[model samples]
Target chain A: MLEARVYVIMKPGVLDPQGKAVKSALDSLGFEGLKDVRVGKYFAIKLDDISKEKAMERLKGMCEKLLANPVIEDYKIEILDIKS
Target chain B: MLEARVYVIMKPGVLDPQGKAVKSALDSLGFEGLKDVRVGKYFAIKLDDISKEKAMERLKGMCEKLLANPVIEDYKIEILDIKS
Candidate 1:
C-alpha cells in the first residue's frame, strides 16, 4: 500500500475569502504579525497494490480530473509513505 | 523569514460532509476504486525576521488560537523553509 498526500491552493492572484476569515479570527484572538493566511485543501489517498510509478501517474490524473481547479488553483502531491 | 504550512483535518470519528461531496463528484466523473476521501485544510504563513524557535512557538499558538477547532479537528504544522 502507498499513501499519497495532495495539497491544493488558490492561485496567487485569486481571492481567498475563507483564508481571510481565518486571519481575522486569528487577529481577534491576539495573534499578531500574521498575514496572507491562504487556505487550501489537503487530501490523503491509500492506494491498493500498485507500483509507485503507476500510482503517481494515476494520482496526478486524479488531481487534474477532479481534485483541483486548474484555472484558479495550483496543487502539489507528496508520496508520504509506501508499505508492502 | 520562515514559511510555515499547517494542515488541519477533521478528527477520525468526525463527519466530513465536504469530503463526501468530493468523493461523490469523483464517482460521477468515473473515478473507480476511490473511497474514504477525507478533506482537510492547509495554511501557509510567511513570517518576518524571527528566530526559528520563536516562529514555531508563535505559529503553534496561532493554530490553537484560531486556525483549527480543537473540538473536531486535529492539526499538523510543517516549517517548510526558513531564510534570512
Candidate 2:
C-alpha cells in the first residue's frame, strides 16, 4: 500500500475569503504576527497494489477533475511512506 | 527560521460532505478502489527566530483560535526543520 498526500491552494492573485476571514479573526484575537493566511485543502489516500507512477497519475487526475478548481486553485502532491 | 506543518482533520465520526461529494465524483469518473474520502487542511508556515516550543505554542493557539473549527476538527502540528 502507498499513501498519497495532496495539497490544494488558491492560485496566486485569487482572492481567498476564508483565509482573509481567518486572518482577521486572528488579528482580533491578538495574533499580530500572522499575515497572508492562505487556506488550502489536504487529502490523504491509501492505494492498493499500485505502482507509484500509476497511483500518482490517477491521483493527479482526481485532483484536476474534482478535488480542485483549476480556474482558481493550484495543487501539489507528495507521496509519503509506501508499504508493501 | 523554522518551518511548521499543520494538519487539521475532521474529527472521526463527523460527516464530511465535501469528501463524500468527491468520492461520488471519482466513482462517476471510473476511478474504482477508492473509499472513505476524508478531507483535511494543511498549512506551511515559516517562523523567524522563534524557539521551537514558543513557536509551537503560538501556532497551536492559532489553530485553536482560527485555523480549526474545534467542534468538528482536530489538528496536529509538526515542526519540520529549524535553522538558526
Candidate 3:
C-alpha cells in the first residue's frame, strides 16, 4: 500500500493558542532556545491501487476540499513508501 | 533558526474515529483505492540556539509528557532547516 502524509497548519499570521501554551510549558520546564512553535494536523492516507501521480492529484483534491480549511490553514502532502 | 517537525499518530491497532470519518467521506465523494487512513498531530517547533541533538531530546520529552499519549500514540521527530 502507498501512503500519503498530509500536513495541515494554521496560516502564518493566525493566532495559535495551543502552540503558545506549549511554548509556555517549555519555558516553565526550564528549556531554553525556544523561538516559536506551531501546531497542525497530519494524516497518513493509505491507498491500495493508485499510481503516485494520481495519488498526488487525489490527495491535493482531498486537502482543498475536506482535510484543510483554506481560509485559515495551508496544507502539504508527501508520498511515502508502503513501509512508512 | 532550526526547526523540528514532530508527527504524532495513533499506534497501529488503536481505534481512530477521525480517520474513519475521513475515509467515509472519501468513499462518499467517489474516490477509490483507499485502503486506510490515520490522522495525527504535527508540530513545527522553532529554536534559536539549540543544537539538533538537544532539540531532539527536548522534543521527545515534550512528546512523552504532553504532545502525545504515550500509551496509544507513536511520534516521529525530524530536525529541519530554518527555511522549512
Candidate 4:
C-alpha cells in the first residue's frame, strides 16, 4: 500500500475571502503579530501497492483531473509511506 | 517575519463525505489502484517579527479558537521559516 498527502492552495494573485475572514476574526480575538492568512485544501490518500514513481505520476493525474483547479489553484503531492 | 503552515484533519473515526466523494469520482474517472481518501484543510500564515516559541504559542490559540473544531478535527502546526 502507498500513502500520499496533497496540498492545494490558491495562486499568489488570487483573492481568498475565507482567509481574510480568518485574519479579521483573529484580529478581533486579540491575537497579535498577524500579517496574512491563506486557506487551502489537504488530502490524504491510500492506494494499492505501487512504485514510488508510478504513484507520483498517478497523483499528478488525479490532481489535474479532479483534485485541483489549474486555473487558480496549485497543488503539491508528497508520498508519505509505502507498505507491502 | 514568520511563516507557518497548519494542517487540519478529521479525527480518525469521523466521517469524511468529501473524501468519499473524491474517491468515487476517481473510481469513475478510470483511475486504478485506489484504496481510500480523506480531505482536510490547510492554512498558510504570515506574521510580523516574532520568536519561534511565541509564534507557535499564538498559532495554537488561533487554531483552537478559529482554525479547527476540537470536537471532530485535529490540527498540526509547522513553523516554515522565520526572518528578521
Across B1-84, the per-residue lDDT of candidate 2 in tens digits comes to 677778898998999888788777788998877755778997766556677889889999989877888899999989877545
Off by more than 4 A, model 4: none
Cα lDDT, all candidates: 0.83, 0.80, 0.89, 0.94
- Chain A TM-scores in order: 0.92, 0.93, 0.89, 0.94
Mind sharing the TM-score for model 2? 0.83
lDDT of 1 by residue, B1-84 (tens): 668899999999999998889878877887666656788989987766677788889988887877888889999988866545
Which pairs of residues clash in candidate 3, taking residues 3 or more apart in a chain or in different chains? Answer: none
* Candidate with the larger DockQ of 2 and 4: 4
lDDT for each residue of candidate 3 in B1-84, tens digit (9 for 90 to 100)? 888899999999999999999999988888888899899999999887677888889888988888899999999999986663
What C-alpha root-mean-square deviation, in Å, does candidate 1 show against the real structure?
Answer: 1.8
Give the number of the best model, judged by TM-score: 4
lDDT of 4 at B34: 92
DockQ of each: 0.66, 0.51, 0.84, 0.91
Ranking by lDDT: 4, 3, 1, 2
lDDT of 1 by residue, A1-84 (tens): 667888999999899998888888877887777756889999977666667788788778888998999889999988766545
Q: Point out where model 3 deviates above 4 Å.
A: none
> What's the true lDDT of residue B83 in model 4?
44
The candidate that wins on lDDT is 4
Cα lDDT of model 3 by residue, A1-84, tens digit: 787899999999999999999889877887778899899999999888678898999998889888999999999989987663
Q: Output the worst ten-in-a-row residue range by lDDT, candidate 4 chain A.
A: A75-84
Total colliding residue pairs, candidate 3 = 0
